[model samples]
Target: MKSKNYDYYLIILTSLILLAIGLVCIYGIIYYNFLAVKPEWSSLYAEYIEIMNSYLYPFLVLLLISLGLCIPKRLLGQDILIKSSALILGATLVLTVIFNLEAGLGFILAVMIGIQSMVLIMTFRKSRAVRFEKHGYVVRLGSSLLHLGLVVLIFNFVTLRESPSHILIFWTGTLLITAGTIFALYPDRITRLWYTEQ
Candidate 1:
């Protein structure tokens, strides 16, 4: 990667880490409507602090790194970083699952993350042989949207039961997934507006 790109990535990584920390600090403050009795928010917050201090932080670190690894080659650049990151991601996931390590949302995210990485890697390799893919940007954008929708769907498992229905997000994600699939699989059939190049 170029120096400018590295700088941007560094900025992004710093921002994501800061955002995650902020989220973790505010985690227990989230209100759920269905509790039979108002429990001690302070104790709950303390318990989570302890959990994070004990071992959860490492898992979060790994997760953030995995997220970074999954950045598409088109966004990050066509570098060996993608391949290396994929290998590291797969190894971390397999070892974590096999060893029975525990972290909140770790198991669910692991499966989806692994699958996403594999799919992206395979597609990156296979794209060169694909035919009827006239507009490269459309396919790449669609692939990114498809993955984003899949991730959104996966997060449904993490929400509280009493929280507002995720159906709206679900349908929106379905739309993105459908549109993305069409853009990726039938690029040639896409309208002429996407063809800006001669």
Candidate 2:
């Protein structure tokens, strides 16, 4: 008798998923900064840089992927209400791309980022809240907020790079990370404010 390799299946599936998302995140961070500033590489390929800096291609791909995810396989089996809505959304995305509708594209991009940000925050809250509580209340709350702040600060660096508030964001993230680390390492112990002789 032979057994199914479920462990391998899970490992491979998780690894691929993580790599896919991580690669895109890395690319966006690096390329967006590239678009923000013209170094030797951008200067060398000025034509290509100009095209990419416009952001149409990346926006099209991202919008397509985001809207495409709406038409789930389960929805395909459902009644017209759900399926029609999905179809409408799909068609809207297609038309937006075909027509190069600036407003629609911008709105969709905002929606995509807003939805993902909400999900990301919820994920951090749900997963970290419990784990941190195990250590202690002060550690849990302090560390979780600090970690979230650190992430938000980093996100600002990426998206709000136009202002170049580098010093503030960098220090904020560094402080958050440091405080979170301290909270994580702080020992869990009982404390007494005043001792009375029994």
Candidate 3:
């Protein structure tokens, strides 16, 4: 029992630490890749930066909510968190589908929100009692969905602007999406060969 409790603590602590690192990296991406290249708000880069900035709150909320669940909790709170996460993701995914089909002002928003939804959905699913759950499951699945969505979105965005450079982004995004999906779907098999007797 003590060992199991210790394992739980380790998992939560590790997750928290990684979450912090991811937040920093996200901010760095915004700061260095987006904000640093701009006349502030005049270009697509600016729009991307602004959109990423919007994710700060959601990311923080997710981290906090995950922390809440990492501790002992009443069933009500767990249910609330689980359902709310799912709802948020589901709503965003629906919006993404709408945006993808409609051709409108919210293309970027749709893509980003879609990615967010994918992440939240996978996170919620992993937090459940699935024997298949593991460290990379949620992130890999979410990233795969996000990558695939971005491939299409970026292709459209770049094509609309008549740019050739973005083709690299498209290919890389597809590769990442494919790799992530492979990992998410077959993590146990992939890692099994790496295992040695404990």
Candidate 4:
């Protein structure tokens, strides 16, 4: 039987979901920072922080679910899946230690990274091996770009509070996200010449 074509819709949907979440998080962080400076907003800030903290776990869960859906069907084999999962977990652990991440939030972040990494690995493997149809190539490239953008945004989010170069990081993340969006939405127009050869 011929292999099933990739689900471009699912990839785009998942990327949008992730981008929405990242934007929400960035907004929350920036708003919180702004509120911290004003004495009158103390009560409001506290409430906002409480609400964000309370919903964090559920949000992480949602992110994981969306990311899980982005994984290609080709990577569903038992051995490859296990290996990919292990690799993700190992990398997450190492990063957590190196960064001195907090216990609770760090664990959640690690889990999120692990899940994203698994999907990314699967996507990369499939895109490399398969000679995708035109739409398939676009979907693969778009999804990969979006994933890369999300990773940058996540890193920015994590360090937003503590980093001295906050403005620089913020701009970097924004640029990445913009580029990803462009790539995802206009893959055909953007790569028509190069992709024709493939």
Candidate 5:
């Protein structure tokens, strides 16, 4: 019996579920605050809800890009997917750097961009590997890039906060520990073994 080609189905189902969850989270956050106040004095609620909705925009973009990554069955080759994903990741990284000037909002946006880029890159690599029937160096580089991006994200969150010196010290330690784990696990354990010769 032949195995089923369910990759596209899986991707679509997963993306839809994720999108729904994100939308629900945004709605709940806005509605929870909306319900806690009286209508007469809650005119600012509209602005608050809009601001909350803005946060879900990145997640929506991510969901769409993930769907785009599932195009191998429709396309003739994997090259298109890999190149397009890399281009998207590069463009998003540039935008992330440009938006790095602010604190909480900027940090969240930057991290979201980084995470989306990682997902795109990984999907691209996975498709390319399936086409070529061999593992390559791109996956290793993608893993490293993801780990570095996560460390930067953590640092961005820490430095954005206005806290006492003691808290800063604690955050510094936390960042170090997290970065160390990424370094040890990403190249040596997690992604490295995934691409090892079978």
Candidate 6:
């Protein structure tokens, strides 16, 4: 029988792309609003923000589409719960775009959190070895932390539009990225030593 599993490399590549896009979006928003404070750069800042806003949602939608393609259909399963969750998440994202309502965005964020949590739970339950294996753990940990950073970012978006929130988002994202890099590059011996009890 043909394997039902998707290529792990493909999943990891796509996820890394998604993470980069998300970080770029966050950085653009932060830079335009806070760092581009010079009087002369006002027009440039406005132009940049305008261009980014115009393309951001469409890019996100495309990312979701690509992610769906990358994920194995069998893994998702044909179930009422999965269908309902997908429908609700899609509707919430559409509402967020149309109304730009905080509640709608919050709902979308909540749905994302729920979905990521479920994914992580299932992954851990099925693949304890993957979670601990040096290379395998990098993929698992990087993806999980990336999802968590994205969720926190969505919260940062919905909450007060202040420096504190921006700082929080930046630091949280940076931390996730930094940790993922370390996990990916460090020697297996170090990872094993760190994770294993003496």
The lowest-lDDT stretch of 10 consecutive residues in candidate 4 is: 66-75
Q: Summarize candidate 6's per-residue lDDT along 1-198 as a digit string, tens digits.
A: 122333455467668777868877887878777647867785687678666755565455444434433332313543543465577657867787787645555565565556565555655465542222224654565555555555656556544457556886768767765765565566475458767965
**Model 4, CA-based lDDT:** 0.56
**Tens-digit lDDT track for model 3 on 1-198?**
343564486467758766875876767676666555666645566666556545543444343234323322211244554575556445644654575322322333343444444454554466453222235654445443544444454434533445665666556667656666765677677567446433
- Any idea what lDDT model 5 has? 0.49
**lDDT of model 2, residue 120:** 35
Candidate 2, residue 75: lDDT: 20
| TM, every model | 0.38, 0.35, 0.31, 0.52, 0.36, 0.55
Considering TM-score, where higher is better, how would the candidates rank from best to worst?
6, 4, 1, 5, 2, 3
Better of 1 and 4 by TM-score: 4
RMSD of each: 14.6, 10.7, 17.2, 7.2, 16.2, 6.5
Q: Give the TM-score of candidate 3.
A: 0.31
List the lowest-lDDT window of 10 residues for candidate 6. 65-74
Task: Give the Å shift of residue 52 in candidate 2.
Answer: 10
Per residue, candidate 1 scores C-alpha lDDT tens digits across 1-198 of 664576467567757776776676565244222221457655566665555444445535454454545443333343665675666566656755676433334454555555555555555565552222234656765675576565555454333224577777677668867887887776665635556553
**True-vs-predicted CA distance for residue 140, candidate 3, Å:** 4.9
Candidate 2 residue spans exceeding 4 A from truth = 1-135, 185-198
Model 2: lDDT to the true structure = 0.46
Which candidate do you rate higher for TM-score, 4 or 6? 6
Off by over 4 Å in 3: 1-114, 117-161, 193-198
Q: Candidate 1: misplaced stretches above 4 Å?
A: 1-70, 77-135, 160-162, 193-198
Instruction: Please give the lDDT score for candidate 3.
Output: 0.48
Which TM-score value belongs to model 6? 0.55
* Global lDDT scores for all candidate models: 0.54, 0.46, 0.48, 0.56, 0.49, 0.56
Screening candidate 4 with a backbone cut-off below 3 angstroms (N, C-alpha, C), the clashing residue pairs are none
Please say which candidate is ahead in lDDT: 1 or 5.
1
List clashing residue pairs in candidate 6. Answer: none
